[model samples]
Target chain A: MSRQASRLDAKKVNSEFLTLTYGALVTQMLRDFENAEDVNKQLERIGYNMGMRLIEDFLARTSAPRCLEMRETADRIQQAFRIYLNIQPTISNWSPASDEFSLVFDSNPLTEFVELPPDLTNLRYSAILSGCIRGALEMVQLEVQCWFVQDQLKGDNVTELRVKFVRRLEEVIPAGED
Target chain B: MSTYYFVIVGQNDNPIYEKEFSTVNKELRKEDHRHLTQFIAHAALDLVDEHKWKTANMQLKSIDRFNQWFVSAFITASQIRFIIVHDNKNDEGIKNFFNEMYDTYIKNSMNAFYRINTPIKSPMFEKKSEIFGRKYLLS
Candidate 1:
């Protein structure tokens, strides 16, 4: 596929449509759930569902090759994010085993002009992104645990997410039965 | 060339859609194959639940075998399950078929009126799946 066709056209969607719709959705969830923690979990669950399906579209559009290493997976995620969302996040802090890493976003479009109430300090405003990553990775047979370690909305300079590779899922075959 | 049965099960374990087809290379009487295929697909569900948590990959190839019947499965993150039963054993072809079905499922889900885990009644989805089966498996 041509690179131009793979990239999501920003012209097709109005910027205000994304900003307003996402902002309103979050606000509605916060109201319906009536608890910051519940709202955060709900957002993550919604993102998880969306991510499950979105990965198929991502793969079809990018035609990306399967990553042979965790580092490559991180790079693929970065490329996917850039092409789909038009934002780039720096990936760093790889563990010695190369099973864990962090993604630091300089600017998060989801939280533009958003402020968390003092009572909702415990809520992870960008938990949905983490959920998306987790769901997408799981689909590719990589079981991972992803959570936000820092958020710009919470006075952090950058939004940081820590992803820990749990284990590779192995296909089970009946032993001595086939 | 053999008969094939395809089933889409909801997260709640309810069947949402099903179809049966035979390979073009060999003709099998549809009436003769109908009940056996349904039984095979239904019997494979228990094995699917047994093996689902053991792996994270969507394509669960050849989860169960009963006599000559073989079953493979593809699971979505929302917990939807795509199960296939066939007399011929070809894991690679089944995986590719499931991937196409997954794409169709995603498109169907995008409809504003469609709800997750509900029986898929869209004629568009049905037609696409039929075409995929004819192209990839029947021929």
Candidate 2:
């Protein structure tokens, strides 16, 4: 049983046209739930579980080097989005301290046909993206807070994901070393 | 976008290998959904048997349909069956994927260290399956 579960990593090799199905799932979940916040929470939880599993597949496929700096990590993440979803998010809006940055997506596959209804103003249609980033980063020993500050589905010009470096897990790096 | 549930059935109608090709772990985890897919796969087994001798070709395009899902079947010379339950249409892609998998199965089933008609444990097999699956089916 466990071996079968482990073999599931094979399925994560592709992510093309996946968001449409994911969108269907999200829409289904929206109908099931009365509150948009709860829907967001559900989507986040789903993305978290997906991230925890997908990181292994990502690591195996990409063989990306261990990132010593978060800046490099952001670049690698951009590469990942490009590879998996065929979207390259521009890394911008860096904080002065360099502990935070925003990933600006000019085109998001998830929101291609998604339109937020006026009734569900609080729904983050793609909260799963944030949860996925958080969970994938956690596997690499990074404790980062990630969320969507702007979404195209929510009438934003573009989709922007904000990631904040909280603290590194199981590490004791001295300050000023970046 | 489509979801494919692929399974390889060995002798005695036993499942030797299985995979669900979709965005992994992203689907809403309702317990009944998977059970329904499984049941559809099982229900199509008798249909596969009924159609096995109808065609001379190894590939049996699609044998059954359960609502939105379609069951496609391919059989080996030794009667090992590969079944895929999917939500959309892509006959060419599924045929290409099965051909690729059949090649790997030939190599794996011939291995001295590997047992016949049992679970395939080779990393190379899984790697090629994923690569070809993405190439032919999910592209």
Screening candidate 2 with a backbone cut-off below 3 angstroms (N, C-alpha, C), the clashing residue pairs are: none
lDDT (10s digit) by residue, model 2, range A73-137: 89988887875676899999999988899999998877653445567678888898899888899
lDDT string, candidate 1, B90-130, tens digits: 77778888999999888676543346788887777889888
Chain B, candidate 2: TM? Answer: 0.92
The list of candidate 2 runs beyond 4 A from truth reads A1-17, A171-178, B1-139
- Position A119, candidate 2: lDDT: 71
lDDT of 2 at A65: 83
lDDT of 1 at A31: 73
Scoring only the A-chain of each prediction against the true A-chain gives TM-scores of 0.89, 0.84
Candidate 2, DockQ score (0 to 1): 0.01
